[model samples]
Target: MNDPIRGTARGSAPAPLSVLDTALAGRGVSAADALSGSIALAELAERRGFTRYWVTEHHSMPGVSSSSPAVLLARLTAHTTRLRLGAGGVMLPNHPPLIVAEQYGLLQALAPDRIDLGLGRAPGTNQATAAALRRGRSDDDFPQQVVELLRFLDDDFPEEHPYRERVYAVPGPGQDKENGLPQTTGRPSVWLLGSSGYSAQLAARLGLPFAFAAHFSPDHVAGALRLYRDRFTPSAVLTEPYALASFAVMAADDEHEALRQTRSYAHSMMRMLHGKSYLVPTADEAASYPYTASEQLVLDRWTNTVLHGTPDRVTVHLDRLHEAARPDEIMIASVGHTPQALLRSTELIADAYTLPSTPVPVSAR
Candidate 1:
């Protein structure tokens, strides 16, 4: 029997690509520098005609600076005009649903149509950090939290709901008024992000778009997508199932250099696995680090999930991934030892795929 997943040949039309930045600090770089790098990359992505520019949320990590996506997005809005800014995502379990809605609602008010709210159940941090962030709250009720979040966003609470009359999401959905009530002027588009079938099922059941974190957790990509499509139901937000598959990618002029840049990511992962701070190391440092056979195996497994090569080779790899997953959109999570290399990788991929260079109109923004 043939494999369930299909494969696309080289030179095929590429799917829409977007960028997912973690604001990873390079060796000897400060978090401020990393954030500046993220803004520069978003500007580049906008110029390259990429679909969206998403920043992730992480806590207490020396190498990552995107601790608060909403705050970062607020800064990003001043630097970018047309690129869609979003949290790739905010760990919903870490925050109250009302606050999440209010924050994203304010974002929408700031940039209007160019805002997205990607919600995830994961703490986006380690267990100890998760505990500190949660502060005695239970994350076991994720489904209920999601429902409540949606209700807050839509201002759709029932008449008898206790909070319905007591609270309201400011700058509500749109400019529609009734009985002299101030109409809601903005609401960010929401998406469910996950690396497992549970999130897929939830997104499908709720009719929200789903984004799978194949970049780090490759094992569940196929299963999650399958479950999502198989069980999807239409909702007011989405008429049909829409899924985005995020992949770790690095492309360069030379295949060897591209592969070398990935060594830093490998070292970072190894550190994370060993319960060490995941500060990105230099390529030379990563190369010189001694590893046991078992540790080497772990590194190899983690690195295998990333696509790294010359632009031509990387393009072919992306094509195959698109064919197999059949996601509506493809999101690239690019990392490197240097800011220049990371920006160059994105540029090379955009050129390889012949992505448009036109910016979204200011009128649209």
Candidate 2:
């Protein structure tokens, strides 16, 4: 298929498309359904040629059910073969480095080359919850924690290191070879997820891939990416920098419907900003809710940051963003309240980009 807006072949489209998902639970969706929807969407993403599927972590958030990204991603492996599945990030501060390494290590063992372990510095919840999850641990130690986690993943502790030979992530590096297990299931690729320069710089120093969270923090996208490329240092994981930009995008066959969906997301975001219950409102609810002048301004600002419209319009905007930032990949974080809307938006965007859908072989399935 060809790009609808540019009338060019799919290969010419800006960059490879991937997915960033938060198993949203709100309005007509139950928590179980949200998880199930993620599975279905990942399967579709693989068939539609999306590069990878990354689920983010959120804790005790009313409208978010993706509290455990590793668990959700585990389920996805059974449903898809080609799709690269990962935690958009596991909030490192909330759990011990060894635990996080073990979880992802086991995942790598299960999914082989298809797993990714994206790390983030921030706690994905409020202060109270962060305290509860972290106990007395300090978030300021994030960089150190990342190094420790990587060591566990690689099973490469120096002789002088305290944990060398004393600790290990069982399913991690050398496990398969030592135990005579299949070597096909290698370790997960690492990526740093961020909305600022700190994360970009850390990723650069370590020579890991960097994925900017433009979906939430649009203002820093260009600057953060620039810092990453400028300060990059070659390492074993990467010889050069690889950057991925994620954006909140929704595409529909009809422009009006797309607008309504975006408005619904705006209302939900407004509620979140105000520290309200954070349930996603339906499009009809959003359309009928009376907004104060200030609230309307907030809504407008949020909507402007997102790319929403017909498939052609959205793809055009995506191409422009790619040209400006020059990310190696473009990841779409669909912001629709309902599962069906999310699926439809994904399908429309794939069609617009003419992404080839390779059917899964029966044996693989």
Candidate 3:
């Protein structure tokens, strides 16, 4: 099947690539250093022809420092000139819709058309942190929250709506009083992020671009994308289904080095699975740690989900993934013990695909 968004048939070639950063902070790496690494990664991604650099939201994880995507994206705006900066994504259930609108509106003001607002319903954290962040708010109202958020972003609440004329999101869509024609200060591109069929249906109904969380929920990727495309309805924002799949990828100079990095990342995942703090261990630490029978089973399962090997090996797997899912774009979430490892993976993947060294203009994207 042909994908209108990319103007290509499935499996013909890889689609546009992007980055999904977690700002890993562990193995003696400070939070500040992790953030700096993210900035450097963003700069390199832009130069390597990646279209977007998106930061994911996670809280109470000792190894992750990208808890506030909007704040981190604000910093990213100052570092890169052409790359699209976005939250991949902000957990909308954790904040008021108006607040989300205002925050992203501010980003648009800073970077204009380069800002993207991807929203998710998940808390992006454990139960206790979710409770603290939500303050007893119900997550069942996610659909309605999206509606209200869109109104604020477009600044187009109907006349009968209570928020119309009573409240406003500054730096958002508005009308010119003199001519009465509507005007907007560059509204950011809005995308719906999901890991299940529910979010896929919602994104379809809302006519927004959809991004599947394939990095973690690999089992649900195909079903979610199928539901998204099958039910998609056209809207002003999107005329056709646009779907992106995010994968956890790690590439290295050799298969052995990649496996070493994978083990380090898997050790962190195992700790989180066992309810321990998600502080990533160094490769040597992972190699030396004694693993019980059950832990080895768990590590083997998690390791299978991560695409890791030499650049050629990883690229082959990515191609197979593209052939099966046919996503309009692929977003990479690289994992490693150090910033240099992640950077090297990114450089290798870009070179393997022969990605341009020049920036892809906003219009072209």
Candidate 4:
């Protein structure tokens, strides 16, 4: 097989690649099994030289098992070594800043430098679930909440600040000496995730790393990148702008087989668009579904977001995306009919990119 991803970017260094798993439930597979699959995939990604293994947050979705990224990441920490595990991300609007800070602070305390907290303003579920999660709170406070969360994480609140003395982000920056707990130095690497210019500008102004969700929302990628770059300023977290763009990909040994794997993903998205249960259908089931002309148009648009082909062909498409987006890293979101197929697609892409495999360290668990 010809390696299409062999060369470096056009006049630039080869960008790092990472994996984003949503733990999509397959046909006849239980949610527990899907989560196990995610763990297996993360283990594979670590051995395959992938930079990071990120799990997504989605609530009330029967197809996705990753409703709580923090909880899942805690489990993943004991299962794999050398792979940066994180929420990619935790929706900020769904929880209070203090709670988010403390949870991730504990995670960092456990894993040290291997934890990342990618924050997003969007709710990770449907309207009903969002209401339940937020209780009656408005999302208008997102920017302020972000600032508060960062302050708590860094323990940078000034003496005059109202919450400075009253609230300490326990197990975080300011630990109580009376409790006899050793002061922790672990701090999570924070990244802002978004699909629009609003988050791009905020992330830039805050000087944090940014990850754009171009895998689903491709319309605003270029503009968001430009805005982030133009508005970025040096901060405590970063000296320069670093951006990662995610894309849905499914590579296989043959073009026909690759396209076949994507049918389930397309059908899943179509079901979501129509407010139906978003369970991932089998490829055979997806193919058998009747489609109206309008529905076919929707499916075509949804499936177009996915890069499905043989490894060589997929690599070329990824390279073009890299050239156009100029992101510092490219994150792959691969979904398939079966666990083996998904694993194979990820392996093929990693191999095409010439990623060096590393020996998995003994499980810390």
Q: What is each predicted model's overall lDDT from 0 to 1?
A: 0.81, 0.83, 0.85, 0.82
Q: Each prediction's TM-score against the native?
A: 0.92, 0.94, 0.93, 0.93
Top TM-score hit = 2
Alpha-carbon RMSD, each predicted model: 5.2, 4.0, 3.7, 4.5
How much does candidate 4 score in TM-score? 0.93
How many clashing pairs does model 2 include? 0
**Tens-place lDDT digits, model 1, residues 172-287:** 65224433666545467789999988889999999888999999787678788989999999987678888888999888789788877887888788888888887788888888
Per-residue alpha-carbon lDDT of candidate 3 for residues 212-300, written as tens digits (9 for 90 to 100): 99998987888889899999999987899999999999999999899989888988899988878788899999999999998998888
- Name the better of 1 and 2 by lDDT: 2
> After aligning candidate 4 to the native by TM-score, how far in Å is the CA of 337 from where it should be?
3.0
Which pairs clash in model 3?
Answer: none
Model 4: how far is 1 from its true place, Å? 37
- Which residue pairs in candidate 1 have backbone atoms (N, alpha carbon, C) closer than 3 angstroms, thus clashing? 172-184
What are the per-residue Cα lDDT tens digits for candidate 2 across 1-365?
21111111244468888888888776878998988788788988888888888999988787779999989988887887767888898999889998988898888767777788888978887777878998999779888999999998888889999888777787775565567665545567888889989999999999889999998898789899999999999998688888999999889888889988888888878877777656788889898999999789888887877799998999999998888888888889888678778888988899888888788767446
lDDT string, candidate 4, 11-56, tens digits = 1225878889998787887888888888889888878777788899
lDDT of 3 at 107: 92
